[model samples]
Target chain A: MELPGIAFYIVAFLTMGGIYAILCLALNMQWGFGGLFNAGIAGFYAVGAYTAAILTSAGSSAHLGGFDLPIVVGLICAGIASGIVGWAIARICVRLKADYLAMASIGIAEIIRLAIVNEEWLTNGSLGISRIPRPLEAFYSGRAAEVVFVVFVWLIVAVTFLVARRLQQSPWGRVMRAIRDNEETAASIGKDVQRFRTETFVVGSVFMGVAGALSAHYFKFFSPDATEPLLITFLAWVMLIAGGSGNNLGAIAGALAIWAIWSLTEVVTQQLPPDWATRSSYIRMLLIGLLLQFVLQRFRSGLFPEKSPKLRISREK
Target chain B: MIDFINFYLIPGITLGSIYALGAVGVSMIFGILRFAHFAHGDLMTVGAYAALTAVWVLGIPALAAIPFAIIVTCLAALLADRLFYRPLRDLPTIYTVIASFGVALILRSIVQTVWGTDSQVYMTGFQKPTIFFDTFRIATRHIQIILATAALTVALHYFLSRTRLGKSMRAVADDPDLAAVAGLDTERIIRWTWIIGAALAAIAGVFVGLDTDVHTNLGWNLLLPMFAAALLGGIGKPLGAIAGGLIIGIAEEACTYPFFGDTLIAPSYKSAVAFVIMVLILIYRPQGLFRGRLM
Candidate 1:
């Protein structure tokens, strides 16, 4: 017997793939471009999703569900809220280097998650907010709606990618790279390195927020459980590191490859014997670890290594 | 208030000793290797499992299994370092951190696969509750844990201060290159560091399991608290970790008591309490309370 409705499966896969692409790009800009080792991308993503959900869910006639703003507006608000949170964290913790920065960001992310979990009045706690208004609910429904959502998401991804590319080539991007390569040199050139770092952090985080908002709308639900670090944060890190840290396209490629492999593994595992299928999920985690080790060993520079501006421009020319 | 002290304070000290032991291993690894070993928690879990396995499968006594578990864990640590870490020694510290995370995931998966996901209680017929007074009662297991933690801490302090190898480890932590130049065997020191730290972690894990139940997520859940304690005490300072752990543990418990009949603070906020304390300490004194060497 074959699984039915393969079309739905394909659409779902692409939809998830597109959202992850956006998430990876956002992480790429922060870690790849700015050399900020943020371990809290999931926190920001959750913040955006919850922010939109909460804002739109408030003032409703039934169980805090009424404000009813447009999906685009909610998305924008999510971006702004996440940007603000990112900016605040950067301001406080950006002065530290690798290990300290990682610890601080992880701590901040945990705090964000805990706040979301405990602040039942605001977040509705673990029960989660549901019945979120879909964009273009009147015009599109079912598979057609999913297709339209995917297109809209890809549109956002394209716009964000272009903007990020432009920014990376700009004078500001050069200064950011300069700081990443050599902080002392950047400071010697009279660049306010901390401010630039914070700005890059906020901008990158805004993209993550936007991606989260898109995901929330697609799912039409939001929960504190979704904000946990293990779910989204590490996956994004793996994608970025596996693909190529400093390259946006590499991030997208990494996202797609890893997710596809993950999904395919799940599908294949379901076909195994009962005992084997039961243990396969654990084995899959081991495989992911082994895959990471393998990737680190063979392609330390990642799949699509960061290209110099001269090479990139030449290719374009 | 007196009842509160008898109940919360004493129990907090018992719990804190376990946290302190775990933190010492984490802090030492961070000190020498210069990376947050996310796998440290899983190492502890593995140690607890080792002890549990020794008791259940090998028919060893719980007390006897503790030392054996520690030794096995030390060997495991050495193997991990040799296999995974030694190869990446030349890379950036961040790479090591990521690799440690990979190691953690692998260890967790392996444990789950072999033992299944059920919580394991290592009850080697060693269940006795000790009563201190009419109002105060403590588990004999907890008292044993506290005593063992004290003994281990004292032994570790002596070893670090008086032993030549321990001095060499400190030197390596200070500067690997300088230690190498000063005729210290850097590789040997690092191996010893892993052995000692992992052994300590094993002891802590077994002690914790004796008092509670051993579960897969036990180590992962303890990770943040370990970090908090290590950071609160200077990261590399073992004694400071003890003090930091006690302070955090007591504060977490104390905060949960209802003040003047107002709504009692939820116990779920325990992690938040530790986190808040950690953030405050970091903001005020990023170097930590004891202000020892950067680790």
Candidate 2:
């Protein structure tokens, strides 16, 4: 590949890697801090992506789109939309045991998918939406446009990272960890576990939605296929767990590392005989699944384990 | 009324039987293993494909392939437990749940690679439904599936209530620590749970193939309804899961009937029926209809 070609490839890689980093951070908030099992990250993601697509895309007769709003507005609305969904799901399912919550969340994701596919009037069915605007697209074109978008995505990732890090050190984070470590003890200490969980879930879902919107903007199109659970939900879970669940930096590292493995393996798989073409994707999925099992068993805490934030005050006081 | 019975009720029962069979496994696993086996649906897919292979290689009827399917699926379930789930047994149940999600993907991918992604069946041509009393019409496979499920349910009831191993299995599910303290062979009971669960799942897979086509997403698509059935029946209560499965399956098919001059819900959204029912059950009765475990 040429230098520019390789640079362009790197840009594309980082853009997706950044988006996935946001997803991992969002998941870290829920699973890492809150200990809530949200297997429906894809649902919130779809909600956000579709919301942005419907709001910011050019007017179309195929689906619900005519607003042609600003990309910023679309992005904000995406976060809000996903947050609402997360709140509703958490209100009902957050109180359930971890396993039940996982089951319920998967059901919700499936329902969301069914609606997105069947409700053609709203989402254009399987045809998907096109002509989604990229952030500041008018200012750049071609490779420059790609670079600009990657920067935008990384900007969001930086903001997300800062916010997540702040939350991890906050008193709220301490309460969340307390509840996660032992709900009964947290409750005994006068913390409303349910309310805190609901808050954490909603907060996490907002970022997941933002990540989804970023993807929509990156692709300049939106489709149900992009919201696949295996790619979005499962990948994010693997990334967080592999990267180190409780630590913000681990989330980003895991996202980039896993995303690299996910995308680069295609290069090798594409070299196989033509007969193995269709089966290669499945082969990758198998490898990824095995990798998850390996990481869970061998690493357990991931590459970057969580470290408790130290108190600023001295015991002498 | 006859149209309702023929078009709605009979298909509902047929689908419910499949769900019931699959839900039994889910309920038993939940009861004994204390984790939602998300890969259970894929085990059904594995069974369907196994039977498909048997039919292709042996030139035998699909029904005749049940034993092979059961044996293959039983092995698959046992291998997954030993390789993926056993080490995580000491950890929290969520780890196993996540691992099962991975297993679901692995199983689905394996089936896709082996069988190809296209939908297939044991027999391609459609068969005419047998007429009952010159008024009631039912497909032959439906009758067979329903009868087989009924027999299995009866056998399961007897095994749990009468057999020593079955009793020990229930004892472990009820309270693992107590069962262990009581000198029950927890590992042995766990093995039986997997065997029974895998056997029923294989039969259900074959029945689904009989009713429709064997596709990669066949079991994954039915997973929500099966889980709904298990939840409705009460998690851990095998009998309750059967009842739950029947109600969910029937409701899913029947809800689309043109009862009031139009269908209550569009057929395209039939899958949503299961999700709605599951949510309602979660909100109203977490213990399930049979008063199983609270969680």
Candidate 3:
């Protein structure tokens, strides 16, 4: 490939990796700090993507769309929509044990998926929405457009990182960690553990929504297939666990590292014989699953373990 | 009324039998191991494909392939435990859950790679259902599935209430700490739990294949309803799971029936019935109908 082509590939990689980073950060808030097991990241993601798709896309008779709103409004609406779903789910299932919560969340995600596929009047059924507009697409074209999107994605990642870091250091974050580490202690201290968990779940879901919208805009299309749990929810979980659950920096690193593995495997698998092409995807899935097992078995703390800040004390002693 | 029995009720009972079989395993594992075994659906897939393999290679009847399926799936489940779950046994349940998710992926992918993705049936041609008193018609496989499930339930009942191992298994599921303190072998109980769960799951898988064509997503698609049945029955109660499965299965099929004039729900949304039921149960009766464990 030529220099421009290589550059474009890198741009695409960063764009996707950056979006996954946002998802990882959101998940960090929920599972990493809050000890809430939400296995329905894909549902909130779909809500955001579809919300943005409906709000921003040009009017169409095929499904619900035509607001032609600005991308920023669409993104904001996506976050709100996703956050609402997260809050609803959290309200119902947050108090359950981690395993039960996970099962309930998965059920919700499946229901969301069913609605997406069956509600033709709203989401165009399985056909999905098309022609989703990218940010600043009118001002740039071709290679330049790709670079602009990559930069845009990275900017959001930076903002997400800083926000997540701030939340981790905040008093509220401390309360969340306390609740996660020991719910009884936190509740005894009048911390209201359930409320904090619900709050964290909503906060994390909002980021996931934004990430989903970003992907929609980047692809310029939205489909039910894109909202698959394996790609969105499961991948995000792997990234968070692989990177380091509680550490924001590890989230980004894990996203990039895992995303690299996910994408590059396609390139290598494509080199196989023609008959082997169809089976290669399964091979990739197998490899990824094995990698998760290895990580879970060997590196429970992940790549970057959470480092608690040292308390500053007076010199009276 | 005849139409209801023929088109809806009989099929519902058959489907419910399959769900009950699968849910028994899920409930036992959930109660005993204290983690949702996400790979369970895939284990069903493995059993179905294993049975399919037996049919193709041995040129035997699908029903006859049940033993082969049981053996293969039991081995798969035991191996999965030894390799992936045992190491993480001491960690938080969340880690095991995640590992099981990974295991689900691995199992499904392996099936896809080996069997190919296309849906296949044990026997290509359809069989005529035998009619009873020239009023009701029921398929042979449906009768087999329902009867097989009933027999298994009886056997399971005796095992749980009669056998020493079964009693110990129940004891452990009821209270692991107390069971340990009482000198019951925890590891032995865990192994029996896997065996019983996997054995039922394999039978359920073969039943699903018997009912419809076998495909890669065959088991994955039915996972929600199985979990719903398990939750509805109560986490630790096998008998309750059977009742829950029947209720859910009947409800799912019956909801699509047109009562007043038009269909109550769109056929596409039938799957959501299980999820709705599960959420409601969780809100109203988390301990399940059998008054099982709260945790």
The candidate that achieves the highest DockQ relative to the unseen native structure: 2
Error of 1 at B39 (Å): 1.4
Would candidate 3 be rated incorrect, acceptable, medium or high by CAPRI criteria?
high
Model 3, range A1-317, lDDT digits (tens) per residue?
A: 99988888888899999999999999998999887777788888888889999999989999987589999899899999999988888888877888777888888888989899888999998899998998898999988998989989889899989989988888888888888888899999898878999999999999999998898898888888865576577789889999999999999999999999999999999999999999999999888989899999998778898876455456796
Instruction: Indicate the DockQ of the complex predicted as candidate 3.
Output: 0.84
Candidate 2 chain B, poorest ten consecutive residues by summed lDDT: B166-175
Q: Please count the clashing residue pairs in each candidate, in the order shown.
A: 1, 0, 1
Candidate 1 residue-wise lDDT, A1-317, digit = tens: 33647877877888888888889999888888888877778888888888778666546433344467777888888999999988887876667566666666767777788777787777777877887766677898987998888788888888888978887888888888999899999999899989999999999999999888887888888886654456477678777789998887898899888888878889888898998877888887788777777776677778899875652444544
What lDDT does candidate 3 reach at residue B202?
91
Root mean square deviation (Cα) for candidate 1:
3.1
Worst 10 residues of 3 chain A by lDDT: A308-317
Candidate 2 residue-wise lDDT, A133-246, digit = tens = 998888889999999999999999999999999998999999999999999999999999999999999999999999999999888888887556656888999999999989
Instruction: List the global CA lDDT of all models.
Output: 0.80, 0.91, 0.90
Candidate 1 structure, TM-score to reference: 0.93
Question: 2 or 3, which is superior by TM-score?
Answer: 2
lDDT of 3: 0.90
Question: Could you tell me which residue pairs clash in candidate 2?
Answer: none
Model 1 stretches astray by more than 4 angstroms? A1-4, A57-66, A225-228, A311-317, B59-63, B124-128, B133-135, B259-265
Candidate 2 DockQ, CA atoms: 0.86
lDDT at position B52, candidate 1: 87
- Against the true structure, what is every candidate's RMSD? 3.1, 1.1, 1.4
